[model samples]
Target: MIVETFNKEKRNSKTVELVCDLGITGGGTAGVCAAITAARKGTKVVLIQDRPVLGGNASSEVRLWILGATSHMGNNNRWSREGGVIDEILVENLYRNPEGNAVIFDTVLLEKVLNEENITLLLNTSVYDVTKSGDTKIESLKAFNPQNSTEYIVKAPLFCDASGDGIVAFKAGASFRMGAEPKEEFGELFAPDKSYGELLGHSMYFYSKNTDKPVKFKAPEFALKDIKQIPRYKAIGKDDKGCRFWWFEYGGRHDTIHDTEHIKYELWKVIYGVWDYIKNSGEFDDVDNMTLEWVGTIPGKRESRRFEGLYMMTQQDVINQQQFDDVIAHGGWAIDLHPADGVYSKLSACTQWHSKGVYQIPYRSFVSKDIDNLFLAGRIISATHVAFGSTRVMATTGLCAQAVGMAAALCTEKGMNPADILKNRSIETLQNELNIVGQSIPNIPINSKSNLISEAAMEVSSELEISEIPFDGDWFRLNISAAQLLPFKANQNYNFQLLVKADEATELEIQLRTSEKSKNYTPELILEKQTFSLNEGEQHINVEFLKGTPNNQYAFVSFLSNDKVSLKTSDKRYSGILSVFNGVNKAVSNNGKQVPPTDIGVDEFEFWTPHRRPDGKNIAMKIYPAIQSFGSDNIGNGYVRPWGEVNAWVADLNDKNPSLKVEWDEVKKVSEIKLFLDPDYDHPMESTLMGHPEEVVPFCMRNYKIKDLDGNMLHSVEGNYQTINVFKPEKPLNLKGFIVEAEHPSEDVPAAIFEILCQ
Candidate 1:
């Protein structure tokens, strides 16, 4: 090969120009989702990431678990997991890597993006410059990949900045806020004061493993010499690894964006110093065989710049559970804020206050107010400092970014801007598109315009009639108050009979409670209360609520804690049915009840949460006039997930081959059908670090097939573990009706489906 050299000139790196329909920066959960969502809609997308891997904080580099509305299942937001592409990723991760190996998770994300033919992924590329078509519209972006020594000029009509710090928006001169607003500014009572710190900080984590033999460690000179310098040093132990060190934070008081390296160094010093104390300081025994297996070089950032959009979400929107007409997404993570002083300060690591239920996120909050073609996504979306505390979580931000993706696709198709879509009342069109892909918007039902099943006659092989949860020879101690959440129709009287054993003669308290808001799981309104006298032996106790339920919602049949009594639990598990406890989760709640100051403007209530499987069994009880919420008609009910009611169609436990048939008066051409199955939305499928107990959710259909009227198989799927299953024949099928047959994933759990759509 011959090499030619230029004389008296400075040569630039190789430059490549690419044009796409949608351009997204930062390949975190949000960017990954945005790219995938837009690509699936037939839009050409370019995904840019400065890091080698995707998932941002959830990547193996940083290794923070992906959590959203479910809030680690520590709050009352039941069945509130974020849906669409993120749900698919988390569910796939659980099936492929239940142990939650972060490296394996990286493969899952890469595989997902690679599977899409329309997405062009550019990794290790950093955006440094922006070219604008006008003062308010970005024309192109200039990014360089240091690893390849290449320069890229990416041009697109629409641009989304999910880059954590809003790099593109900032470079394009989009309006942004970097610090907290005062209390009087937005009337946010929970807004932090100047003394309390206005921003959350960066955190780093390290993992340790036993080497089977003694290992030696030496601290560098830069390592912190004194472990006592950390205020919470006493809380550290041999088992303190991974996210347990989330409190090992710093630099909130500093410029989070420009001073990230400084903050990272401080965190590293603290980490190494803590390790030194554990290895050489003799604070922990049997640690000689332990060694640091991995240390995150890049820190997981919590807060920085927030771009302003057409609408700014405030604390009131979250606390009041505001419903927006242009709703695009939902959030249920508590208003979690960390102290700015981080590990150095004596203040608690974080302050979290949960709302009664999930809140809607409007599409207006994702479009730039100044930039005509720009979209703000991820933690940088248009939410005030107070509201950002809850919306900043990865999964919540990912869902918001998904809305941006769909909006971009719509904007590209209609030749309109993001604001025009809202002004023209086209948000419903956007919402319907998202719902088609399995994204759950609060209070938004699946659109029936394209679903032919809505016009068909539906019949199921068998329906579950909830009459009893028979005793399975398992006894549960009444060490803590517990309640069974049961669905009831409006103006329906309910009678319950519970089996309990008493240690001695005592008074057992039973109460019927429900949330003031039907869609919420919080049990705050007590409709009826009764005190029953129990003898010294096992007996049946009857409690009746003659007033009946005020609305069609889940009512909590509550039994207060009494050490002298033990209740019976059943092994039978059903969809949309759960037993909750009035106790502390410690991770998300400090005590069993939240009694905040009156001036804080947040509600004070007790946390009623469900325990993880292998322990959270339903209470053994019988009800008069069994509730029939799981009817055959529910398959076309428009609602996909359980809202105020059990919107799923569950089959009887005795049906060996469960099936649903949708028949039309005349033959109709069907190109595709989508099935919305249950994937245990209540389970917080953390993408990393936290391991799952099952490879597939027990309530999901493991095997299913679609058949025509002549009993000919059209399609079949095995080992399915996803929430949304799409069945498309090689060619369009013309038929009068079709049958969907499915097998229960587990013998103990019955077959259930939320909604089915045919086109």
Candidate 2:
């Protein structure tokens, strides 16, 4: 049903009531994701948003671009996209709004919620009151819409406060803390020595569009009079939009929740002032044709009331990259902190520190310690200000919301509180459920039970192989030795292929090493060593090694420094792989050199590094084995490219009929097939400082044909830019096995199948 009032307040007064399994306050990315997840899991859900549009911040009203783990493809951390629901949103947005249009993204988010049959979406409804059955639980949420003069009473078994500011939790008497915590409180070095009780602040962003003819902009009377007053004046440009004006922030020292109106006015003045300088201050004459397209009315918020939870994440936890046993979501963004002084600060508007790798967001972080039934997602989750800087990203929060929704689904099923699910060690079950639905957890692979490759005999025609190490037509000096972590089973035998470019014939030493489990997240103890002589120019070197099945899961292929030998480098960071620099754990560059922690974070960078180049370097190598040999693992085992490599079974275009064949011991009746193909997550879906938005995801399998072994064509599917493809038969096809073949495959990229899920 579409309900809108043209006037701001004059409309019919209506009262509406809804009852559901889960009631979610706020329609930010986190709330939308939670609603979508729980609804799809067969739980009745009600998603309430104050704005007429669904997306918070990301909606047209706020105009903040959605960013998460990728951190704008920051260094080393490629393929760090917050998978699951956010991935769906990003992928769909790429297809629908490749230009990154704010208005279009609004419809996309709206459609996502409205399409969910199990989700009752109430837009333009603000939660003004909460009805509590007891001190520990909320019975219902009472919301009112002034525009339509409608009152809403939402009753539910479980409630989620994804409200960014935690209004529901606050009203419910949930124990919460606002602003910066003292370093002693959490033993966090990054925290202030004394509690400021100050937040990161709210920001307003402006977008500009180009006109063919010259256009002029007149300064609004409220615009700041002097451009020199801005701190990062040089950083502002005509193309700035959304997060580009991150420095246009204020109201941190003030009560952000209560003082939002004042903050909004201040943000407006700063935004208009910046544009005025660009258009009229004689500094940017090139922008004569550009005019204001949009300016956010609602400031995108960073920190607010953080509800106390079983675990309060701190800077120490983020800095150490702590892996929690009860991890539900993970964050890779740097611990970014904007000074409470904001635009007025003489120092940089933001300061960032990187972690070695991604850190875990525990399930305990979302479950309220005081309110038994209240779950928190988004900025309102339990975290000190320093830690909140990292977890506050929409993508990370959305994943946490996914966890909450999944946990809520289980709660609805088992008739238990959110805390009971974790305290009972049912978190494993929850994790398994999350993994089954394609949510990525750090250090966790797909559940073995759901892995079809484990049960069936699997065969791949060929692994994607290239003769020369694919390079960007550039070479690096052999100053530091490098290695990449490759997954290895105890019993499997493997060899590596290198396309070494030597200036002269030289002997290069190679070693295979394993790590001390997942602790260091780097290569340790050399297992085997060998030396190979390479000729000038590009030469192939294959170092073969066989070992008895071992206990460790990862082995590194390390190369010793050989003078005049230049190794190939790739920007891509493959999953299950870590690189070494000069024998030290150098995969991540924590040189204390600051990079603008773009929306993704300083934890990720634009360039990967083989050596500590403060400028930036590629992290992974193209020098991998030609063909990998393993036992009895199906294509699904490799389907999830958790890191960077295309997790797929490839078939050469030279082959007569390129296909991946899977067979079982007996005739297995299958009705559905789920295929997760490569959508090239490495490509940017939206515009960034580095590049424009990618209109389409290249390298995806297209026009593929799935058939039975009897030469009968079961179905033909066109890969229409979808990452996950589900094919269901009108009736269950009684078949023993099937083959997916591409008659005319993608030319440059070989036909690859990540996984084929059959049930």
Candidate 3:
């Protein structure tokens, strides 16, 4: 039920019910990315998120310099500048904070909100409840802020839960999984048996400018008394980068939930104790200007909950670099594991080799198994302990946010669920969009038609294990759920159980049906919707949607709760849908096609009108009369076509008789003027720009008041073809190059692109 709504007309407005469009939760990495993604797609959106500041970990809060995909020439950056909004923020940060320090990021986040008019930001707020009618749709969501104690009931057809913890999804009845599976299951060399729940530890980030500076302080009584019990107590004299750091830490067993407060209490003690040790040991005799400037208020947790999504990704999928039409992202980091006690444990399973390789993360990782509206990002995405180790990096998580954001916006524009988008429409659109932003979804073929997952592909053999996957090959490129490719042996096959989860719990029944009904086996599995007493953090869980059967379609995954959550899921979600490749099915390149070209036509009339400024306001524009002969061979059409001159004119309340006559001399205030020549009329010959006179420059057109009735003038600018930026007149302008600013922006930040002084 889509209603139409627009900005009401001033005081005298008409009653119009606009359909709620898009709703987003969280203002962190994923949340902001999703909002920008949707807004870029021309969707009007309401971006609701917690925290007054954005850029969760990559922000001033944690003060971690963002690491791109891969560093070129060992610089630690992989040309990830294509993420339009994200890069825009980074560039702005560099300008405002030339040093790009972690203490300030206000300028970065604010620039995006101001640039995109389609996005409405609701910061310092959290989504409390999600309302949904059934599996197919969302009604509205309720939000709350301590300052504004009043809970806001925001209504939007499309809702994106980018909260790192998957809170909305958990509240919406999403299903999820956790811990590591047995090595025999996924056959991932790193996976271990049983669920230790010991995951990657959280980081209490801090920045120190001087390493040689030392200060005097007393050790804490508690740490000194309990120093013997602290695990891995050996002081790491140097970190990975050779800085004197401490791998010596603990918190999980104590209380990871209240980590911030606990860390502050313990860190202060450690700081004093360290000074005493160094001072007493005479390591720092005469050091100065060095101090723990600040420590993170909040510890960035690497792992917590794992949602059960449509498909569970695994290390095998990554190891093989399996090609999937539904590939949402790619990760190259090894599975990094943290000890259960928030300390560096010896029980690790990450291999450094994978860092240089490419692996595909399918689109299934976005949604929760049971939670309907919820999506997730950061280290908390859906993956087994080992797999999570690989996918839990900031780079991949950012990609995940981008994927879900596009899907959520699509759900709003097209009255359908996100899963439906994957089931019905082509996944290629999402991939292409990501590519446009310069993300590398390596599996995306060149110009393929529809990038979608295969219907149903069971391993079929108990002995079908594959080890080495091609990083840039096409023949063996395939897309299968992590469950379908797990427990890899030289030869073996593994089946999967269809499951689901959601924000709230409700009765969800599932059944496997044959494509034609003439089947010897088909039974429905009536799954009971199980609800958990979800807390305010991340809680989305993943569940299998189907048992071991075939011919499954429309597997439902949803929750039942507007304020809390509700969900429904079926085992058999889809079957038998093949993706259409551009020319040859897989990625066999259409460039091989032979061409038969003949004579092309000429004097073609291409009618097109430039849209008004994207800022939603019209510009102060003017049109000039074309002083041309009756019939000239529009010879060099490399000029801006002039309006008037034997052309039809449309005006707003000015004249009954319009003419295309120009004065003998009119100063040219406006440089370029465009006209629309529809082919529906006669296709005229080439238009011309004619002039002949010593000082009578016929090319200079007149300035005839380019204004609206209300009298507003627009600043007209011409951008350089190379760099798509409007050239500022007073400042040096160049389209050829741009500045590669620091990680953050500031008022005195130097430009990344060199300036081109226009003579």
Candidate 4:
């Protein structure tokens, strides 16, 4: 290398220009999903991220767990996991990095983006300037990367702003709000007042490791000396690390965007001081071997600038579970808001109010009101401050961003603006495109007109007629009330027999309950209650309900808690079957039930949540007059996942070779076939810190093969663990029918499929 001679004047940085179909600012989960979805739709995308990694708050630098409607399986939302590319990412992460290492998760996000040919990822690049076309649309963006000392000018027809602070939109003169609105502004009764704080704050977390030998820690001069300043300092323990310190926050009282550095420094002081206390406070035992392993350099920001769009989501929209004609996304995370003073305030750190079910997010909330070619995404989407509390979570925002990405692709193909896609019948086209890729919209069925499978006749080897759950697993004590969720039809008398062992003679009360809403699993409406006297030894107890169900929905066969009784649990697991408990999951519900204050404008209901794998076994029981809901015809029902009913067709456990045959009247040219399999939507599959029990969900199909009418094998797959599997033959085949042969993931678990589509 040759050194250049000193010049009288400094030289400017090198400039580069790029052109693409879609340009996205921010590489958070939202931006990442937008990039992936748009790329898959044949749109050229340029993703610019200021951070070195892709996941934003979910990245290694921040290390926050990715959660969505399922809310870590702590709420009543059943099968409510966000679908589409975000679901694929979470499922893949669970299969590959079940331990949830933050660094490993970073690799997963990077690999997904890299695998897409149409995505051009530009990391460590920050957009600082925007060039406007006539003051209504963005013509191009000016960005810089200090690492490479290069300036970038990116031009695209359409742009999406998923950056947490709305950097691009802000520079482009797009309207935005940064603080809470008055109650009268949106009729939000739960809106916070001035004393309670308007904006949420930033948080920082650190990880610790235990060494076999003793370790020493010394605080720096700038470290906080008085740990008692934090009211909840006593809650910290040897195991308190990572997201457990999510409440280690500050800086809501100041500017969240411009004062980020000042906030980060204060967080560091708090972290170092807490570490120093853990090592030297002499208030606990056996912490001498603990040492600080990693500390976050940047703070995870919660609230920032929210851009205004055509429609602004309000508090009533979330609390009422409002539906929209142009619904594109859904969110179920509670209306969680933090105190303005953050860790310093004694006001419980955060307040969360949950709705009865998931709410729909409309496409109108994604298009910028002023910028013709700009789309809003992530936490920056148009939403009142009250509603933003729920939509700001990583998974929810990522899902909304997926809609933005798909809209961008549609805009590029049709040569229209973001707002035009919502006009005429184009919104339906957008929804259909999203559903084709596995995006679950509330109350919206997959109505793809090109799915030729809907015109064919289907026959299966055997359909599972659920009559019994054999006593083949462990005996779980009735320390907490437990219930088995069973799908039932209307006007059908139900009788259940459960095997239980009682320490002493006791009266076991069994209640049949169902949710007021068909699609929910809250178990609020009690249908029938029966009391049965049990003997001292193992015995079978029978309970009969002649009233039956009011509608076709899931009924809970609830066994109230009895310390003297233990119920047998079955190892058998099904796609839409689960056993829930009337217990508290402090993460979502403070108590076993949510009994909110009278004026909070939130519903009060009991949280019936399921336990994770290897623990939440189904209650061993037998039902009279077996329920026949699973049939081969369900494969073309247009629903991809369980909504108010079991939309999947499950094969009988006894059927050794389960196969499905789809036949048509005449041979048709087919090029693509898509199969929707069971991936256990109830599981949250948190991306980091919270490790999963299994690499693959128990309901996933392990192996499968496809064949034509002439018995020629088209494609075969082994060890499949994904939700949606696609098979494309080498060339289009003229076939009158096709057969699918699948192997169950396990012997006890039957093979189940949601839908099959052919084109």
Q: After superposition, how far is residue 4 of candidate 1 from its true place, in Å?
A: 3.8
Enumerate clash totals for all models, in the order shown: 0, 14, 89, 0
- How far off is model 1, as Cα RMSD? 1.0
In candidate 1, clashing pairs total 0
Candidate 4 stretches greater than 4 Å from native: 1-10
TM-score of model number 2: 0.82
lDDT of 2 by residue, 267-308 (tens): 899888888888888887688799898788788888878888
Angstrom error at residue 441, model 2:
1.6
Provide the global lDDT of candidate 4 against the true structure.
Answer: 0.91
Error of 3 at 163 (Å): 1.7
lDDT of 4 by residue, 688-718 (tens): 9998999998899989999987889998999
Better of 1 and 3 by lDDT: 1
TM-scores, all candidates, are 0.99, 0.82, 0.53, 0.99
Residues 177-270 of candidate 1 have per-residue lDDT tens digits of 9989999999999999878899999999999999988899998888899887898899998887888788999988999999999999999998
TM-score of 3: 0.53
lDDT to native, each model: 0.91, 0.71, 0.41, 0.91
RMSD of each: 1.0, 6.2, 26.6, 1.2
